[model samples]
Target: MGREELVRRVSEFAKESEETILNQVRKMGSSLDWSRYAYTLDEKRASAVSHAFVNMYEAGLIYRGHRIVNWDPKGQTTISDDEVVYEEENGKFYYFQYGPFVIGTARPETKFGDKYVVINPNDTRYKEYEHGQQIELEWINGPITATVIMDEASDPEIGSGVMTITPWHSVVDFELAEKHDLDKEQIIDKYGKLLPIAQEFEGMKITEAREKIVEKLNKKGLLVKVDEKYTHNVSKSERTGATVEPQIMEQWFVAVDKPFKIPHSEIKGVKSGDEVTLKQLMRTAVESRDIEMSQNGFRKTYFHWIDNLHDWCISRQIWFGHRIPVWYKGEDIYCGNDAPDGEGWEQDPDVLDTWFSSALWTFSTLGWPEKTKDMETFHPNAFMSPAYEILPLWVSRMILMSSFHLGQVPFKKVLIHGLVRDKSGRKFSKSLGNGIDPLDLVSEYGADAVRMGLLVGTAIGNDINFDESKVKGYKHFANKLWNITRFILENHHEGVPKTLPDKAIGYLDELKHIVAEITTEMEKYHLYLASEKLYHYIWHRVADQILEETKEVFASDEEDAKIAMSHTLNIILTTSLKLLHPFMPFVTETIWQELPQKDEDMLMIAKWPHTKD
Candidate 1:
């Protein structure tokens, strides 16, 4: 169904139930095509996700492994970087003795006793022990052992003069585990558990266990000393104010680039898929960042977000998304890993993050996980990624994903733009009461007028403020187009003249230049520029020129006026509709219908205009 019909149906259903996302989508004029809409929880999407995993599995890219993950326990899912929220936290640092050794920690009450004070092999202070051995750690009160790992971050002057390791709770611990090849010390598990070595603490509520263990340690005289006043930074759940527990859990994972390779020749011409070479991508990512910095358009210093990139935790411990396709037959785990398997083992309950599958959306939504015609035609647009709000997260991931999956960049160019901010240069937020309800805008000014206004002075990667004045200006432009076409229909004859009139061809050079300029802007993804150029031509140049000279023609000779007026009007209407199609689909389609040259045909499937590519 088309947008209007879908909206109508949704509106009808919305009235019959409690208001929900569907109601909101309808209210917002999302214009969804219900026939094509698949909920994240829908079977179609789940099957597609399963198919993707199976293909990757057969290729040996998907694997079950232990890795550090941004875990969201309340949501009970392993979240990706995009889903993680990092906020500043105030915490206490406790200094205590573990037997003979002194250790400082932020959580002396919980797993702090689980802390292992590691010393670097190269450090002259601990050079007495075997370079990699975990000595019996006899602290001031208790006995423990920990393998040594290298880190200059461990200051010799810190609390208890030692840094302890809890691989399951801290990223530093996991890194240390990797460095020393510590198996029992690894944070996550083969089956995914906190390990029975944690003693009674295993499977216990982390915070509650911390308190219980601390009390027992004090009773047993394992607690050496306590510093209640020291403050430090600690990890806290962003979604919830509770302290985050880095509990080891059994979760599915895909190893990053496990023996993954691309032959140099096979890598060529791959834009958005599996054939794109790592070398090519490193160069592109570097170039994109460098250009962004030098152009003074983007934030100068984005934190090194990818420097320590970890394996993406694709499983979400939630009911909302595509569940991981693998099924467990008592930990033997039957994965469709190679082919289409159906109807037996229990499917993994965890769902893929909305973005995990959406990273594959450009193709998945176009029938990927199974190739189709749209995929064949539009697989790698030699042009650009069309939207802007998705620049960092969705757009960037799609680019890399397309390269990794299809051996090509998804698109040749990335067209990025910022969100629509309000007049005070603040972003539109509900809390700020600054959001422009697009549907309200549509009702007040019409879709075409609003779209044109949104583009007027907008530039790639720049915020376009939503101002009433700009919308009014576009509304006036629409009115001008309407009035001009109405005048032509009323006064001019239907057919082109047998002989070309001198006046009609008089402005041909200028008209061709306008076309050339607009085409160039569009090809470069400078769409706002294209819109501006069109507006200037239509409102000021063409219309103004006609108003001035056409009056002279009408006064002197009626036939001369009719030929120039009819020819010019047709050109304006055709060009304007073409220019407006990507932004204002409905209004441009309506205008196209009112044109004398075309029959009734939907503009959505109309062949996109050609550029001098």
Candidate 2:
């Protein structure tokens, strides 16, 4: 979607000021000053992509070729494997008679473009249909000759030996078409509509085609059987929910050589537990700090994906995204940031994949290409945390791309997490009626309440079940913090002491210890652990133990006792607020503003608390 249209639709969908992430700055209580360093991908698309293309071209990493890609017909683009979501849905199997043969298919809607069929040659059912034999069949579309290509190592079979092919749709057919030099004519449009070649079925959507084809089959008595409850897995476009087509198309690719050899290639000593996860192996150490992180237990899965990585199809058959920079002049391809110097040079109409631009995000977002101050300051990112699904699609690519350009990985460590599923463990989707809008949560329970609930027991590489009770509980925590601040202000209206009294010394040590613990856990990408620690310390230690003891001490009315209580509360609460800032920024900041010992106007920018006195 274009930036204007994206912003407009997001605005219309939300009922509140901060419904969508477009309102993230407002929802996160971020400052407008941060906007000066940011620009949208589309805003700098032409120039940034040009620089990247030049870099790849000079490195000999860019090439035009044919590759079998996961093609999203509805979105009319090529999405990476990361975007292909496999879901099991209740569908039907249609068994029918097609001319002189019987066949079964889950998608008869795409049957109009059927080219030819293959059968397992070993099967004795169709003994008459021999290998390399020619057969003629009269079809509803036209008269076409069929050549029998038999005994596929894993051929599509109809009954014992019969098979059929849908050339422009299935991956097997695409491979067969390539092997046998058969032609492919797209019988389906970008919107899943049938082309004119289907005649009466032309221009019908998949659902429309399914209804019409079933009716036609029933009328002809060719509908032998219908399995109404045929449960199967379908690869749908994650962007549009439309079924994906496995068509072979020419696309530009960035060839990142696989880190490991092909599967089952060779093994000398590498075994289970020897190397923990891919992330650990790639764990970067910067100066004195090190980041070793991976999602839950998905390290094995991550290594599996990286070991068998393929060249990324970086081109998309779309209009809006960054257009590929290569220009074609009569089969002589010339690729650069700019268009060719002469006329009749047709620039590639296809745009680069959105991730192709994103793969450069770590550097590009920091004002790369010109060695600007931002680039130098943020050369290697401190951390990269994205959803686990994109580890191969985005993270791996960013590593390779940045390593090539800047001689380093983009980030020191990568933190991965799973999706937010519902109470039943099903992913929250519109079809499941369990999608939660962050705007609704923010409006209902306040922003920090929702955030604390999400972070508090969440582990690296884990999916947390969405529950309103958790948010409600955290909302209660926020209320408790507010009341604690109000109570402290009411009792001790005096300034904070320069030094702590003997009674306050123990409390100060614990606060400093908590700060050290939180920093250690956060360094390992254990932000949730840090939040959990803060929750326990605030509710149990500070509120229940220290505050109660302080009240009793203050009841004595000694001037020394009053000053000690004030000093202890000021430093302890102020330190605790700093520790909780990352997980619950807004709540901690608000509470910090009323405290007397604050070093910065905003807790968000205050110096991090440490264990040292």
Cα lDDT of model 1 by residue, 197-219, tens digit: 55655665555555565666667
| Lowest lDDT 10-residue stretch of candidate 2 | 260-269
- How do the residues 132-195 of candidate 2 rate in per-residue lDDT, one tens digit apiece? 7766764445556766767464344435246567777776677777787766777777666888
The TM-score that candidate 1 achieves is: 0.70
Instruction: List the pairs of residues colliding in candidate 2.
Output: 117-164, 295-461, 296-460, 296-461
By TM-score, how accurate is candidate 2? 0.75
**Model 2: lDDT of residue 431:** 86
Cα lDDT for residue 532, model 2?
94
